[model samples]
Target: MRKSLLLFGFALALLSCNKEQAAGGKEFKTAYVDTYKLLEESEEMKDFTNKAKVKEGELSRELQQKAKELQLDAASFESEARVKGMQWAQLKQQELQKRQRDLGIMQETFREEFDKEFGVKRDTIVSQMRKFIKDYGKKNGYDYIYGTGEAATVLYAREGYDITKKLIKELNEKYKAQASKEEPAKKEEKN
Candidate 1:
């Protein structure tokens, strides 16, 4: 739904820009791209996903070791003992299942955290880009500004029009500044 609106708006922006340009002596140029998708494609998201996978592997290994320790067998295996063994196996299976469930919950929590942090970081970066674009457009006589995201109707855009690299660059700068400020505040609160 969000992507659809963005695409529709993008088409409208282009049409509006062209209409305004043709109707008057104005020349309007606009472009749209999804900043979030670009960020997800970045190495940072890959690194985060890799870390989560490693953690899951470690958890699985630990659970396996635990299961081995608990996989005990009695010397005189009677009918009752066999039934007890079956019950023990069932309980062990449940324990393994619970561990998997916990691991899944942890992974979900990490993904949510990553998404939230990425969203904030992307928003900050986009905000900085928007400021620059606004100033640039105003000075260059641009009449309208549009945001590009997953659902923008723009099937294709020129490389020159893609401000993604510029936005990403500006975002890292903005993120570092914000992180620096936040770190000092965190340190002070801890003290």
Candidate 2:
């Protein structure tokens, strides 16, 4: 639905541009960027993906360790239940159930937190890219710069009108510069 709306709006804009050009005998410069390629090839996105993987691994290990401990405790409780009286066994069973519930809650909480963090980071990155593209278009004197892949706004563009590679290069360079600037601050904090 969103893509359809975007395409409709784009079509209207193109019609307007064409009408204006016909009246004024002026040509409009336009280009498109492939969003999928931009995101896939950008250095910032690559870094974001790597960091997310590391965090996921850390969480998985922590969860696995807790689960292992719970398993050991359950085994010990089973042995004790055979020897202990029924009342004592029931009490221990309740305690074990509580621990299991707590573990499940912990797992759910971790998953939610991870998803939230990932969403925020992804939104920020996309916002930054959009702003960068706008600035780039203005600086380069482009009349219209459309996005092509995923929710594609431009269905057909001339071969030379695809600026995906150029945008990716500029975006990566900007990301590299930003990372370099932050590196010093990170090192200072570590010190």
Candidate 3:
């Protein structure tokens, strides 16, 4: 449904733009960007992915530690259960059940946190790319800058109509400058 709506809106825009160009007697320049190539070549995305991997490792390690502790607790309880009275064994069983439940909650918390963080970062990157593309189009006199990706709507474009390489280069340069600017601020805050 969402894809259909987007396609309809895009078709309407194209029609309006075409009508305007025909009536106004002015040629409108248009180009398409390979979004896959842009994201794949983006330095900021690479760095972001590395950061996410590190965080994933940290989370995995935390979970592993908890799992190890749980194993030890289970082993201890099993060994003591045989010697303990019925009432004591029941209490130990309840404690073990509580620990298992807590572990499950911990796993869920880790998953939610990872998803939330990644989602926010992904949204930010997409927004940044869009804003950059919009500004670039305006500054360079482009009437329209379309995107071509996995579900590419652009079936065919002439040789000069694809500006993926130039856009990627500019985006990377901007990202590098932004990263450099933030580095100093981060260092100052650490001090």
**Candidate 1 TM-score, true structure as reference:** 0.40
Higher-TM-score candidate of 1 and 2: 2
lDDT of 1 by residue, 1-191 (tens): 98777667667867677556644575656554455675568575566567756766766676566555444322233444456688776765666567667656766675676567656765675566556666766576554455556433433333446788999999999999999999999999999
Clashes of each: 6, 0, 0
The digit string of per-residue lDDT tens for model 2 on 64-143 reads 99999999999999889989978989999898899899999999999999999998999999889988887877777666
Best-matching candidate per lDDT: 2
Ranking by TM-score: 2, 3, 1
Q: Model 3, stretches more than 4 Å misplaced?
A: 1-21, 150-191
Across 81-161, the per-residue lDDT of candidate 3 in tens digits comes to 888877898998898889889999999999999989997998899789877887887778776777766664542333456
**What TM-score fits each model?**
0.40, 0.65, 0.63
Error of 2 at 150 (Å): 2.5
lDDT of each: 0.61, 0.83, 0.81
Please list the residue runs of candidate 1 whose C-alpha ends up more than 4 Å from where it truly belongs after superposition. 1-84, 145-191
Off by over 4 Å in 2: 1-22, 154-191
